[model samples]
Target chain A: MVEVATILLMGVFAALAIHSNVLRLAIIYLAVFSLLAAFLYLLYAAPELAIAEAVIGSGLVTLLYLAALKRNRVYTIGVVNEQQRDHLSDSYISHVERSKALREIRQFFLLREFEVQIVFVSSALDEALNDPAYDLIVAEDGEGFAAFTDDESYAMLELEMMVQMHGSGSAIRFVRHSEEGVV
Target chain B: MSDTNVGSESTILRLIVGLLYPFMLLFGFYVILNGHYTPGGGFQGGSVLASLFVARYVVYPVEDTDTEVLHAIQRVFLSLILIAPTVLLFTGLVARFPHYRGLYLTTMDVLIGVQVGFGLGVAVLRFAFFQGVGKTWRL
Candidate 1:
C-alpha cells in the first residue's frame, strides 16, 4: 500500500511538472516528484540512494534551475505603425518586406539566445513610446523606419547593426533616449 | 522581481530558521560521523550540511559566503581523502592499527563529507550571488 501511494503521487507530480505553465510551479512539482522517488527508494531498502535523491535532486537542482532562469532575463520589443489606412489592398511586395524585416529582427535576437517578445501596437508611435512598458519601440517614420530605446538598453546596438545590414535598402534610424529624457 | 526577497523579510521564517539551524548542523555531523554504523554516509551527510546554508539563505537573502575559504577547505579535505589511505598503506598502519578497516572507512567518510559539503556550498553561493533567483519572461 505504501509503495502504491508513492508511485501514485510520483505520477501526479510528474504530470504536473510537464503541464504547468508557470516555471517556478513546475520546478516545485519536479521537487515533489523527486521526493516521492526518494520515498520509493526507501521502500526498496535503498536508504542511501533515497537520502541522496531527497537532498540533491529536490534541493540543489531546484536552486540551480531558479538561478539560471533569473540570469536569462526577458527582452520586450514594441512595434508600432503610423501609416494612414487606405481602401486600396495591401501590395504583396510591401507585406513580404514587412514580414521579412520582423523575421530578421527576431532571428538576430534568437541567435544570441535572448528571450525576445515582440508586441504589435496599432496606436500612434508617440503614445507607444510614452507608455514606458516596452524595452524597444520600432515605428514607421516617414520614408523609412525608426527605433526608439532608452540608454539602459545596451543590447539595442546589436539590433541597430542587424537592421542596417538586413533592412532591404530601407533607411533605418536609431534614436537613443537619455536617462533624464522622455521615455 | 519585487517579491524576490520576501523570504528574508518574513519574521516567522527568520525565527524558525534561527531555532532549527544548530540542530540541523548537529544532525548533519551526526550522520557523517556514524556512516559506518548507519545507512547515511559521506554524500548524504554532506548534502545535509549544504542544506544548512540553503535554509540560512531562505531567512536571509544575502551573500556572505567566502569562496576563497570554502575552496581551500575543499582542497584540503580532498587531499586528505587521497593521501590518508596511501599513507596508512605505506606506513603499515593498516595492519598494525586495531580495527584499521573501520578507522580508515570512518576517516575517509569524514573527509569526503567535508569536501562535498564545502564544494556544494560554494556552488550554491556562486549561483545565488552571480545568477540570482526567479524567472523573467518577456518579448
Candidate 2:
C-alpha cells in the first residue's frame, strides 16, 4: 500500500510539474516529485540516497529554479497621465519632457536586460495606484508627477535613480506603499 | 515569480517561521555530525543547512545576507576537505591506525557539510542579490 501510494504521488507530482504554466508552481511540483522519489528510495532501503534526494533534489533545486525565474521575468510599468484627455492639445515643451522621461525610464530598464512594458492606463490615478495588476504606476500630480510603487518592486532603486537624473525639471516624487503603511 | 510579490506578511507565517528555524538548524547539524551511524551525511546536511537560509530568504526577502563571507567560508572548507585527506594519507595515519577511520570519516563529513552549506548559501545569496531583493542591486 505504501509503495503504491508513493508511486501515485510521484506520478501526480511529475505530471503537475510538467503541465503547470507558472514557473513557481512548476518548481513546487518538482519539489513534491523529489520528495516522493525520496520516499520511494527509502522504501527500497536506500536511506542514504533518499536523504540526498530529499535535500538536494527537493530543496536546493527548487530555490535555484525560483531564482532563475525571478531574474528572467518581464517588468511591467503602468503610466497614467491624468492630464491626458482625448481632445486636449498638450503643450509642446511638457509633451517633449514627458516623452523624454518615459524614454529614459524605458532605456534604464532595458540596459538591465529587463523587458520593460509601459502600459498606458486611462483610468483614474487612484484606481491605478490601488490596482494590484500593475507593478509600478507613474501618474501626473498637479504640476509635477508621482511614481507609485509597492515595497516589493525590485527595480525601484534603479527607477528612482533614473527619474532623478533625467526627469527633465519635472518635480517627480517617489511614493512607496508598504504592506502596513504608505511611505 | 513576479518581482512585486513580497514575502509573506502574515503574523502567523512570521511566528511559524520564527518557531521552526532553530529546529531546522539543529537537525541540519545533527545530520552532518552523525553521518556515520545515520542515513544522512555531508551533502544532505549541507543542503539542509542551505535550506535554512532559503527559508529565511522567503520570510524576509529584504534581509542582507553577506555573500562574500559565505563564499570565503565555502572556499576555506573546500580547501580543508581536499587538504585534510591528503595530509592524513601522507602522514600514514590511516595506514598506521585503521581504528581512526571513523574519526576521519566524521571529520570529512563535517568539512563537506560546511563546504556544501556555504556553497549553496552563496548561490542563494547571489540569486537574491541579482534579483534585486535587497539594496545589493547596484549594477
Best candidate, TM-score: 1
Give candidate 1 misplaced runs (Cα > 4 Å).
A74-103, A106-113, A116-183, B1-8, B89-92, B131-139
List clashing residue pairs in candidate 1: A76-B139, A117-B139
Tens digits of per-residue lDDT for model 2, B98-120:
99999998999999999998898
Q: How would you encode candidate 1's per-residue C-alpha lDDT over A67-123 as one tens digit per residue?
A: 666666456777676664222235723552466455666676676656777766657
Best candidate according to lDDT: 2
**Candidate 2 lDDT over residue span A74-157, tens digit each:** 676777777673443448335634664566666776677667666677787777777776777877657555777665666777
> Chain B TM-score for each model?
0.81, 0.83
How do all models score by TM-score?
A: 0.68, 0.61
Each model's lDDT comes to: 0.76, 0.77
State residue B97's C-alpha deviation in candidate 1, in Å: 3.1
Worst 10 residues of 1 chain B by lDDT: B130-139
